[model samples]
Target: MGWVACWFIPAILQVVRKHLCLRHDLRGFDGGPSACSRKGCVSLSSCSEAVSMSKVLPAADTLPTVGKKLLKGRRYGLIAHGASITSRGKLILEFLEDAGIEPPQVIFTPEHGLFGEYAYMEPVPSDEKGWRGVPIISLYGSSFESLAPPQRTLSNLDCLVFDLQDIGARYYTYLATMAISMEACARAGVQFVVLDRPNPIGLSDIEGNIPKPYLRSFVSYLDVPNRHGLTAGEVARFFAYKRGLDLDLLVVECAGLVRPMQLPDTSLPFCPPSPNINDFECALLYPGLCLLEGTNLSEGRGTTTPFKVFGAPFIEDPFAFCARLNEFGLEGVAFKPLFFVPKYDKWAGKRCGGVQAVVLDRRKIKPLLVGLCIVWTAMHIYREGFQWRREPYEFEERWLACDLLFGDETIKTLIEMATSPFEVYEYMNAQSKSFVEESRDFFIYPDSV
Candidate 1:
């Protein structure tokens, strides 16, 4: 196994070179590192030997059956929002089949859709699936706000089962779906069941500030950390408990899951549920750069590489842009200069100067801070082209898109005012203040990453 786990580039580079042509069977390819930036990547060996292995998931061995937990007769709703074969979610899906539990009348899905087939920003429509063609309600689509279905849609189902794979970012929307769904279940008088999955970003230290209630969009429904250190089951329980919703929620906790472990080894396959986000590396940076969705600069969307490398048609000097980023000495990674044209998203066939994110040290990078620089620099260097996306984002009519993402307008306004990093940090403290206090009750796990 690669000691680097899934967060370091050097370790991955070294391992890749050592086994470059050693054999068809190179060890630790999938296990080496999770995700890294391509901005300042000096590892030449990494670019040359990029071979991906297809991993097959394990068959279920000892999944918990419904008969084991239920009192012979109990109704429940199965929320399978975090659907990925790698995590324990597969076990839960199999459990539904193996656990002698009666068929759930209603099944709810989170962001990324049922099979994660929907593109990012595109809402999934309500659909049906299963061997017998079970109805798959799209919680991400037309009725994404709450879990209430036609009393007829959920009429057959008496209980709710919630299980999905979350990448641990506040604006990711899955958490919001979970919260709103819980509320709906509460109102509909349904029992909710939650099967948990670990936060792939790990339950280490929380980053960034929580979004204020007013800043709350579909992304941040509550005061959870940027990279919330809780599982789906735990977060659901927290909502049910703390929010004091009169919903009956139960969690089927995982026995083998743990914190700090990145994907490709979480016992699952990779699915590009959303566009631009294909792996853990992109996911790691998503919490921050996703804010660019509100900006005119291309966050590398509409191309082979998205989010990892962002540039606009006007960015004439890629080198100088990277220089500004390096001056910040952003931790855990370095920037790599590159130039490319997008076939779709922003530039669309026109050559644009940009750098690919090169993750030098995966464990140490401050994605939010780095993302701040990326956005601020866009405004600084390409002031002419830079503009905030206006109009209702995810339903907020007048609120600025950047504000909802950062969870506050201070960061957005601070950048507008060219605030220094030190000043921004202080501002984040205030935005994050209430989070620390309310989290006292939400800390379901010990302070050990």
Candidate 2:
């Protein structure tokens, strides 16, 4: 009986691996029948070896050795953050200095400031005496005018280099900062370059709708999906091509990275891009969970676990709400009723009821769709208590918070009209498919190697 079990286990693993390889589009594995014998059968160790060969390293890891030549003899400005480091855990600035290149003349920081310790939307000041005495400028400020570097700032630079880690969600402001900086460089006749990084959410799973032109803000500057699954370099190229910016743009592409690979799949270290996005799970949930910002509900901002859990004081029956969510049979995630007291942000110091999203399988989770479903479910349960936040979000005061987050007014209208969440999901799925096809030309990495 024991021998039979051992023989069957290896055979089962071989079958499972074959199915997974086909589904994930992994190459080098031929899904053929394995030979097994009663005396000596294939062991689990060998099965593990079969699965390990598909991994790819991120671009940041290869940049120091392969991309350093691009920076030679150029006085450049860098738009980077704390997560802008090599896979070996060396800061990019230090790596440049070690390579005998002068550090950037001017450094620009995104939302969370240079060190990534500041709270979301916290204003960061330009520092002349910081970061090896290089002038540090904050791209994110209190107003739209502050988001872009002044023309004089870029006029003196030969190149503007952008190297921030993006989580692939639209609302994440780093991409917006890059676009704005690219445009500024174009106007100033400065060369623009991006040291590419992997899209933490992978490169194939684009989701949600593009923001309408009127609703466009810093968050929704590019007309891409809520989850644009391209790397930072690819996104820079797409933006430049779509907007017809007549600038010298160069992308130092990451070596060995391929499609359908998220951050965890790569061997690179995970540096939190912002205060709340602390892990790969948070990055996965961000596209959907971030939408909670435009609502009265707490998107778990003040809690240690932001975006992983969400609730509001109005949610009285969390168990029932979670159960209702489960009924939707959303793929790749499960919801659990939870009660939490936030120390800051919406409903601070108040106990709120909500659901904690547990990702069962990242490959199956459609974050944007799941987020819309959660919003729809909450609106249905809370009714009058549920409300879209009217406060200015991402420096856009005229547009409603939800509209700016979603990049479209129709999503809000659909939810308000009591439309089914499935209907909304179907609509978004179609939109996302079209977006993926349209944006294929800008892809630096192909879907298959």
Candidate 3:
């Protein structure tokens, strides 16, 4: 599925290309938001003259705790990561202890270390020193990286629970891990519960081209809108229901959560899913810009600021004057030219030129499209400076880094064709809409919202 501008405007075409525009059809052409509210279709009389509206959540404290109920009578395995299990709604051993869980039998971790202390792409494994002395199992072992659990690991556990916070981008591997564990639980006859959380990137507002099934990876387990509008619990429920897997799956519904709730208002802590994604801006920028990691040019790796900014020592464009990145006229994001030397990762200690993305509206920012534009733009502008890593990603060689990141080579081909950014956005958004419709059966939320 790709972006289809044709349907979007015919329906909710609000402000004739005005930034911060919201349109309401039932309200006499006034931008009052008759469309999906949770989908970033927020109701606004005008950009200015704001009022304190109702909080876009149901209230976390009011909801019944699922972990407590699940751990009521048995000890089980806990599979989580630092970001997956946050202080906001994190499943701690204390919560289980308070709920009278004898003790967790084990903890399974994804690519990032259990505490999210390790750098990106580092394989985190089982640790005897994990929370409350529970052994941390590494799912990314050389032989175990394929999104499924070994039969041996499931022999002792009766149920498994996953509580992760997702930024809702495709390449973020947390969902992949959840998918793998869900399938394994389905196969092993184990009960799996997914505790729900808000999708930081509102579900209604989506972008990016659908990755063909051939472009599948751990990063993308199911064919979904690139910026999917659902929670981890909802994703799991949809996965089990649509796939016809009759596992004893349960989702702890999040309380008081409304669609399109801004990330800061959710009352949830922002824990970087990985080491370099240290802040919300990084995660917000990731959907579009993460591809730089696979390129020879450093995307600001090994520094205090990673993903939010990028720079490489070669072929100067610190000001982006030569590249004309802003000339592409992308929306919702303001690019301020900057330069910096990375502390460690890709281009350590070299002053590389790049811009710090100032996200004007996280609700409207589509990082995936932004990322693709940059990849295509830099590939042409810098000429000799642009080089695909060519190195294997997640231990696969057949696929290039660009292919893995974008989910298909077709995008790369189009980018190389010098396709306009809007055309690219529409293509991706169209594919994404197709995915949303296809995934309708799996949705647990109201169809309209």
Candidate 4:
């Protein structure tokens, strides 16, 4: 029966792949869902026609239905940015005004500020004068202490409403801001409300190791997987449970969203979550490429396609470097050798030998694995030139950037031991599976269709 099933399944999936116009098989030999070639197509069992036709709305859109009841008597502050908009393109503040709901007494902006204009790790200027009349507070400041809302600030508000668009990477910092702010709210006796949005990378592809307890920093506030398969609301629940916080937490669920739906699956417009992440493709690549920040590599920061293209001036052979990466035979992604000059960040104004990582099939690609291979290959081929960044990252100077980004020295050890990428994948995949089992209780959305 097993032998017959294996042969039968492959033949059936091949037919289905052709029928759906899919670029890859509907499922791999391992039976995992492959990337859907059709734009806006969703899930393993569904295509564009099989999934719901309704446009997915951010939880902010449901605010009209639930906000008045929750905020009628409570003084609230909103943690949001420009991307905090409804499906119809109404900004959070504008939606609040239109819905006849009272504006938050104070608005909190994350790392990129309210409009997402600030550069990476740049301190956002706090506006006591407020934007459009509401007092604006910057959560991301120069000091590590400033990453969270002050307890004094929290005390004034009966509730703190969080509505930032998280791109589903641990190092993104917005989720960290949310988790830290939640801790502060718990301390200050404030209710925390999370206006959930879709995990833009989708919920199916959880990867990477959870940072060790000692490696916890602004970038990794909570010990979650790098590609955590949960929404902002789910993370909040997980945080509350893990920390045993005795505080009120409410999650206003998004409409027309499911675990299998990536950002493209939703008809919602892609807003750059941060200044560097300009599109959905950038966000898709961020989980692994973000590790480049801890290295000498230029993560295409100043280029037109940050995260999509990465390189450094030291890499003398672009073609050789790309050839090595492609030889790994990684799935759903391809590396094209190129040269670029960054306008600002790393290797600024210097031509760097690099490669553009093009996503051939989004769903099938393991971005973390792709990123690991890039770094590993570079380290292997350019041993004389490649270097791990030693500068202070996320305000800590104690550990190397790679160690912090990876959550431990284990990855560095693995690379130093000259282990294969598959071995590294085995280690990280084991950790990811453990995280899934532990975090399952906190999941608000169903994992299956």
Candidate 5:
């Protein structure tokens, strides 16, 4: 029966893929309404017209070209990371130089540092000799207070520009950095401009529940779902409106980037926004797999396949675990038995058994749900050994790390009661849908993209 179910599941998934007009490429999935070819797949280029119609222009691209006047004589402070580049493959700093605008007086970098080389939670130093010779500050410094720029820094600039690639997850930290900067700008009376980029996972894919107010931290600043689908610019707008901050907020929107198209579908180069998020697939799984950080398991941190595969030294039967996961019939993904040894993080230098989450169709995967199931399964199967990490997580010493990541204490309660993953997912879905409806007023891209 298990063998028959395995064969039937793939056949059904193949049909579902064809019906959804998904391409066979596992790198990323494009969901534009383009006609499929004879083999029931669409080439990435074939959806160019759809992407063009979306009119997705990153803020950096528009600033020098369409919005040149805005930068004239304005001593701007840019809050950017390595992914902040023009669509034409030029660094934003280089593009500013070509446009005759003075280089930024100060540059602020978020979590992964300016070059995107630092590992997770590593303190990024402020560069006195900044990128391209401007003074650079690290928003992701050691303390919570350091997450926001000082009033003196803000007073030095007329405008603050933010351009960071958000992976559409609330816990990603970039959004929180942007929110803190927005608040600081409000206090300092500086104009906050978000040079927008694609959400990578695209828009219209909202998931998870709003973080409980008490559980809020740097990782979960806003009360939005785990996968809030708005772009960074839109998030800026939302933050301004929700907080009712009396500040000038501008979102320089993206062009030719659409909600249906993931990064791999676009002509844009894939830059790892962080060390672990190396590709679109990693980003896709990140919304859920990141929850592993709160546990003792390795979320493939040291391996080449971070987030794609996860395991622990105590996991006794990888194949059995995979088989049980398959019974859930999770869409757009399949699990395979995996064994790996990591050189760093979690069970470093130790052999571990786990499962590799192979994405069969990006269009159908619910990453948040998949991640919840994996954690719940691990807890149930390895009853005695599976333990939640009690160490300080993201600076919170007392709270359960899982509570902060899940955004509510009820999730832990639900797991303890042995509730099914589907029930938890349904609860999250109900709340997330309402959030999407409520946040529609703040959406810059009100239409599909």
Candidate 6:
């Protein structure tokens, strides 16, 4: 019976994978069959849009029909935002309604407000009368201390449910909010529940260095790599275990999620988690491109495609810069010379020359490595104009934004010393691997590879 079960399980998973590939006509980022098993799958190009994966559903939708029993006698709160919706287009509040649970006692919002309209790093103000008249507390207020829920606020609730779309990056800030809130929940004796979602960039790709302790701030709140490669629920587990939080933690995991599947592989509709991240490609490029926030360049904010394109007013030769970047022969990516003028933010109203990164093969792309190459090339070429941002970032005024983003001054110091890109790659690769091993203890999902 045991032998039969082992054979049957592998056969079933193979059949399911084949069905998903053929039924959805799922294609890789390069617009081809994602794997050799899917070679016979239909081309998605003929169709105007990719077919939705009916099998994949977020945790909100996977909650049991009689979920009211879980919340019947408990005073609970929700920490969510606009992107917290189910595959059926129902919001978190609506899913709760179907589950027969009453409205949350108090709602908490992250960096963006409930509707996700606020700009990057913009202070989100609390609403006394929020959606359906529940008061909304903003976790991202003016100060670093405001990044966590108050003890008094948690004392009012016995359980807190968290559901947010994470972009698979350490610096995204939502992960930080989840961690801080978990700690606050522990202190106040509140149960922490994470309604899990898929890591949009998938779970197989871990990158960059585990930040040093002193570099910890709102952005680098957890000692994870630049691309932590864990879903929100897994992150919650990691935090609770690492911080030794003595609190009840429950994770309502999503249904039909395979570790290797990226956002494009899912059936759920893309709701831009924030004002700038409008599409899957942007989310895919974000972990690396977001490092631009630490530089003087405009990371395509105030433009149609934020993070997809980057530039600065000082670059006089866009073509040369593109050629130089292409010379590195970075895998799965290409650079095209272009010009843009942001309506707001850095270099607003001034035409700036730069390159638009075209991701040809997402699976092969080492985003953090690509980002380091870009920064290094720019520094070498435009030494006079290039400068690290010294502005107050994420409420840490002492260290420069570049230092904070990279998690230490080592990368900055190396770049300043004109170290070889090969050396930088070796250092980052080693550190990233160490973090991946350390994080394995908390992973909730299985990986294909």
Alpha-carbon RMSD to native, per candidate: 13.3, 13.0, 8.1, 10.0, 9.5, 12.4
Judging by lDDT, tell me the better candidate of 2 and 6: 6
Candidate 5 stretches with Cα past 4 Å from truth are: 1-56, 446-449
TM-score of 3: 0.82
Candidate 3 off by > 4 Å: 1-66, 84-91, 143-147, 321-323, 446-449
Alpha-carbon TM-score of each model against the true structure: 0.77, 0.86, 0.82, 0.87, 0.86, 0.86
Task: Put down candidate 3 lDDT per residue, 250-272, tens digits, no spaces.
Answer: 66544435445646765666667
Clashing pairs in 6: none
Global lDDT of each model?
0.59, 0.77, 0.62, 0.79, 0.77, 0.77
Shift in Å, residue 318, candidate 6: 0.5
Inter-residue clash pairs, candidate 5: 55-255, 56-254, 56-255, 56-256, 57-253, 57-254, 57-255, 58-254
What would the per-residue lDDT of candidate 2 be over residues 224-277, giving only the tens digit for each residue? Answer: 888888888778878887899998887766545667778877777888888999
Candidate 1 — worst ten consecutive residues by lDDT sum? 17-26
> Which candidate wins on lDDT?
4
Weakest ten-residue segment in model 6 by summed lDDT:
17-26
Native-referenced Cα lDDT, model 3: 0.62
After superposition, the stretches of candidate 4 with alpha carbons farther than 4 Å from their true spots are 1-53
C-alpha displacement of 401 in model 1, angstroms?
1.4
**Lowest summed lDDT over 10 consecutive residues: which window, candidate 3?**
21-30
Candidate 6 lDDT tens digits, 3-37: 76456534433332110100111122222123211
Give model 6 RMSD, 1 decimal: 12.4
Q: Using TM-score as the measure, name the better of candidate 1 and candidate 6.
A: 6
